[model samples]
Target chain A: MASLIACPHCGPRPKEEFTVRGDAGITRPAPDAGEDAWYAYVYLRDNPRGRHREHWHHTSGCRRWLVVERDTMTHTIYTVADASAEGETA
Target chain B: MADFALLHRPALADAKSGSFGAPSTVKRITLAALPEGHVLHVLAARGSGDLQGLIPRIGDGTPHAARPYGPGQWFVIGDAPLSSAEIFGKTPILDGKASISDQGHGRVRIGINGAAVETVLAKGTAVDLALSNFPVGHSAMTLIGHISALLSRTGKESFELLVLRGFAESLWDELIQMSLEFGVDAHTGK
Candidate 1:
């Protein structure tokens, strides 16, 4: 199908050219962190039902890292940016 | 073969021809078939060293170009329409099940050439629209004026932009505006 997708770094592009990276705002726990943190980093996910963050790469264009805030239930995208606020919480 | 042959312009059946705008302005628009040729299907494997794995086999080996697309997917851009087996024969990483299809998508393609092409592009795109990162023979999917298009570096100061049919008119208008500052001209082709 010919679908239109927007790059968080570069902007809008054909869905064919850009590859979906995955859920965004995921941060790997420090190597020296506790087992609980490591487990969360490795297996746990927020999987929010509402608006969530995703990471995507402009595989065909800018090749920059991007963070996209979108609603999981609906395909409505709210914001696209370079950095996510995931780290600030910690 | 011909240098122009390197371009695979999908075959157009019953194409409607018209003046895009002004003198020296024309665009060949239609649904076309993918050019039949020796298609080279290059599929790289996943992981840290996967990109590196493709370098030694590509001749003159370069690793940096293939990194942005990420791992685990195939990067199919070539002249030869060989099967995945053939590509794998050339490079071992192309072993993944490769899916191939004819050209059926409605794409509005434009070949832009001029000294100020980059300048015109820079006005719309947020990507590092520099010639170096996007050098000749390299391509990326980025947005121009917030409109997404596949930007392929066909030559020095020349690029092939593929945009959706819906966005064609708006993109064309944007192109016209951008080209005015750089002495823009267009030609129609299938």
Candidate 2:
């Protein structure tokens, strides 16, 4: 796990200050999109090995949702940006 | 009718007080519970830009009065309590750019100062307390040993922590424990 996350607003803080909301790349399916799509959206997730973008909430710091792009296998954080800045919802 | 009257009490009133830890003349820490005053949370409306100039009007004009913790968010604090009407009165100052939520009863402040204040505080938090990195008057909202508090540097050797009222006493005790190595004088009296 990435030990430190450089929050866009609060600077670099320990990972304990954040709450991971998982896969930021997934989009919510429409209400009438049918069962398979809704089920996949609700339950299915990609267990990617490297370079993942996820929604992380700065729970104890700025209280802002951030999109953290990092390597799952190496734990190297590539970039962290405010979720709202990219119009990305958590 | 209920016989119990709601008695207001400062959060740290019953917390630990007096000196403790090593007897050191060169590096001792002073810890005190600050006045239970006003704690107003200001949130900017969506698309509001550069509130830096407009937010201070709600503060008491003191140093670090407007402490920004995040984008479009600030905590306007003072040593004086404000009434509901008084708080609402300041709404117009933002000119519909922001809104204020009174948190006076929900949060408490703690003052800590000493020659080794930064060293003592670093034991719990991961923030870089160096003066060069966290200059005086800067504020950060972070966890100090699992407790979320707003840490603000008031001077080179002093800081003020704004914490939730319920956790005020607990954090005070933890602070005392952290400062034990340098000798601490905890004052909870109003």
Best by DockQ: 2
Candidate 1 lDDT over residue span A1-90, tens digit each: 224556644446555555666666666677899999998877776658878766766655655556667777777777766542333322
Winning candidate number (TM-score): 2
Local accuracy by lDDT, each model? 0.52, 0.94
Residue-level lDDT of model 2, residues B160-180, one tens digit each, is: 999999999999999999999
lDDT of 1: 0.52
> How many residue pairs collide in each prediction?
14, 0
Error of 2 at B119 (Å): 0.4
Per-chain TM-score, chain A, candidate 2: 0.96
lDDT of 2 by residue, A1-90 (tens): 999999989899999999999999999988999999999999999999999999999999999999999999999999999998887553
* Over 4 Å off, model 2: B1-6
Instruction: State the interface C-alpha RMSD of candidate 1.
Output: 6.4
Worst 10 residues of 1 chain B by lDDT: B25-34
Best by lDDT: 2
Candidate 1 is scored at a TM of 0.46
lDDT of 1 at B74: 27
TM-score of chain A of 1: 0.69
